[model samples]
Target: MGKITGFMEYERLQEASEEPQKRLKHYKEFTLHLNDADAKIQGARCMDCGIPFCNNGCPVNNIIPDWNDLVFHGDYQTALDTLHSTNNFPEFTGRICPAPCEAACTLGINEDPVGIKSIEHFIIDKGWENGWVKPQPAVVKTGKKVAVVGSGPAGMAAAQQLARVGHDVTVFEKNDRVGGLLRYGIPDFKMEKSHIDLRVKQMEAEGVTFRTGVFIGKDFPADIINWAKETISADQLNKDFDAVILTGGAEQPRDLPVPGRELKGVHYAMEFLPVQNKVNAGDKVKDQIMATGKHVIVIGGGDTGSDCVGTSNRHGAESVIQFELLPQPPEEENKPLVWPYWPTKLRTSSSHEEGCERDWAVATKRLEGKNGKVEKLIAARVEWKDGKMVEVPNSEFEMKADLVLLAMGFVSPVQSVLDAFGIEKDGRGNAKATTDGEGCYRTSVDKVFAAGDMRRGQSLVVWAIREGRQCAREVDAFLMGDSVLPR
Candidate 1:
């Protein structure tokens, strides 16, 4: 540690966000970063904790203390190198990751924790500015080829690792662009797509091939246009490539199976979001789902729901309302009981702060509509007893809603892709694969491996990167009989 008592001396400082009034007009990143001196001060706040639980708290197990110390000592290059050692895409995580590491920080017990995420963001951004990021082609080739399906964080991480380890890696994305969810599902206000573009360029330089708009399974009308109509059977991949890794994300959004779900203005959050991202990338869309001039109602209260609220507001919706089926969490968590772990507490997102009428423990009973389109929501307040919800007596209500977005989260990866390859699925409908023992991450069907949300179910981007990196190691070992790649 550069400064032994620095944690005691420094207070936690967060990066300021763009003002709500100013930032609401455009879908752009507005997080103000720290200056070099300020970043060093923040880095110095890292405590000399012996165990360093923040490393374990992070999904990728980043070398937090090492980088913090390096930053504190003004060793910019070393800080960037240490940060990159664990995370292949710190820039992405630095922006969108929930920063569980802060919750695990020793200083967080009684006071604010070290600004680790901001420091990481600063280090990596500095790395790019100084031209430290570059291609690292493998010195030797293993002559093994691998096909990684999905270009999200998981797939990208796996492809990069495989390419670095001398295996020929080709990433297949079904969209017009390379990045899977990162390019489409995520809003530009959180993380700009330029970050994904630079990484794609770097991966190309590192000998990884990218095939965009390439669907591996049976091509349906919904499938993006690319490559051959002949679906690459799992058996064919086994015969051609040495190994195949499926890192495709969970795409099956949970449907509100209730009546009136077929209303014209009702749509999945994914369907509404991707269009804006595409339009930002210069792809014109017809009849885009516009929240402008409409009373928007978003269902669900997680990150995706928050994103919908933000996007809807940006669309100039007249009013936005969000509903959560669960009871409202406590304003503050009981820290002593849940230290070093994520705790359930009330968290108001930047989007929530912009504008929204939020209600908890409220369930939508049925949607009432006119002219075959959603017009109003019939809902009721719920009371919880013994972990079960019961409607409150006479608490039924109706709210005007011209547009409704379902952000209830994903159920699983699209079954079509899995069915096309005849891969087995677990009880949760995710790819059947384990992360322990021999042939870890190898799907039931030989040579075919699975990672990220496809195997673990819908999860955070940080977790996706971890799974991808680990799966890459397993695939590498399986192909070469042994691997030098880190687990």
Candidate 2:
């Protein structure tokens, strides 16, 4: 550790955020990064814990203590290097990841955790400002070709790793842009699209090809939502490339199959979120689903629902309300009982802080509307007993809702893509694959592999990156006799 007594001297200092009232006026990132001096102080807060559980807490297993010490000593370039060695996209995780690493911090047992995320944001931003993040093109070509489906974080990480190892990599995206969810699902207020664009440029410089608006399995019977200009068959991809990696995320959103679900105002969170992102990218969205002047009800208490709340507020909604089926968790977790592991606790996002009426243990019974449009939502208060929800008698209530957004999270990947390639599926319907031992990440079918949400079900960006990096190594080892890429 750079400072032995640093933890006792400094308290945790978070990055400053723009005033909610002012930030709602525009779709730009509001969180300010820590200055170098403040970042150093934060770095000094990292204790010389005999074992760094924070490393294991992170999905990508980042070397947190090393980077913290490096930053504390004012060696920012080395800190950036250490940070990037494990995680391919710290900027994305630093901004959006829930920071499980901090939850497992040794200091968090008694005091505040080290501001690891803020320090990471500072390091990555500094690296970009100093032009330290550049292309690391392979010196020699491997004379092999790889095809990566979906341009999400997983696909991006795999493509970069494979390209750096001298293989020809081409990333195919069904959307009009490179980033999959990062481009569409996330709001610009949380993370600007320019960050994705910069990484795309860097990957291109590293000899990875990006083909947008190209669907890999458009011929399937199921109608997949894509804006692809061309359709490529699974057989064609198999013949053209030595290896194919499926990274398309879980897109099958869990739907509320209740009365009036067919109402005009009811929609999936994906249907509403992508349109706003498109508008932010300067594209004119026709008949966009706007929450302006409407009583919006966002069902499901998760990140997506929180996003809906923030976007609705930005759209000038008359009111925004969110619902959760499960009971609210304790404000503070029992740290001793759940130390070194993610604990269940109440998490209020920035959107919730802005303005949102949140209710827990409330379930939507049905929707009542007229003229083929949703007007109100019927809900009930329920209690959990004997591992089941029992509705309370005389607890039925109705609320005005001009629009309803279902944000209950994804169920699985688009089935068509998996079926089109004749890939085997697990019990959960995700592409069946393992993460360890011989033939890791290899699908039942030959020469095809799966990673990210496509293989592991819906998950975090950091986990997706971890799966992608490991999948790339497996693919490399399968293609060649050996691989140098880390697991």
Question: Quick one: best TM-score, which candidate?
Answer: 2
Q: Which stretches of candidate 1 lie over 4 Å from their true place?
A: 219-231
| Residue-by-residue lDDT tens digits, candidate 1, 1-487 | 8888888888888898899989999999999778888998999999869999899999999999999999999998999888888899999999999999999998899888899999999998999999999988899998999999899999999999999989999988878888898888899999999999999999999999998766777643342223233456556666778888999888888889888888889988988898899888888888898999899999999999999999999999999999999999999989899989998999999999999999999999888888898999999999999989999999999999999999999889877778777899999999999899987998888789999999999999999999999999999999888888888
For all candidates in order, the CA lDDT equals 0.90, 0.93
Which 10 consecutive residues of model 2 have the lowest summed lDDT? 218-227
**Most lDDT-accurate candidate:** 2
- Candidate 1 TM-score over all chains jointly: 0.97
Candidate 2 backbone collisions, by pair: none
- Runs with alpha carbons beyond 4 Å of true place in candidate 2: 219-224
Expressed as tens digits, the lDDT of each residue in 190-286 for candidate 2 is 9999999999999999999999999898553332346788889998999999999999988888989898898899998988888899999999878
Error of 2 at 240 (Å): 0.4
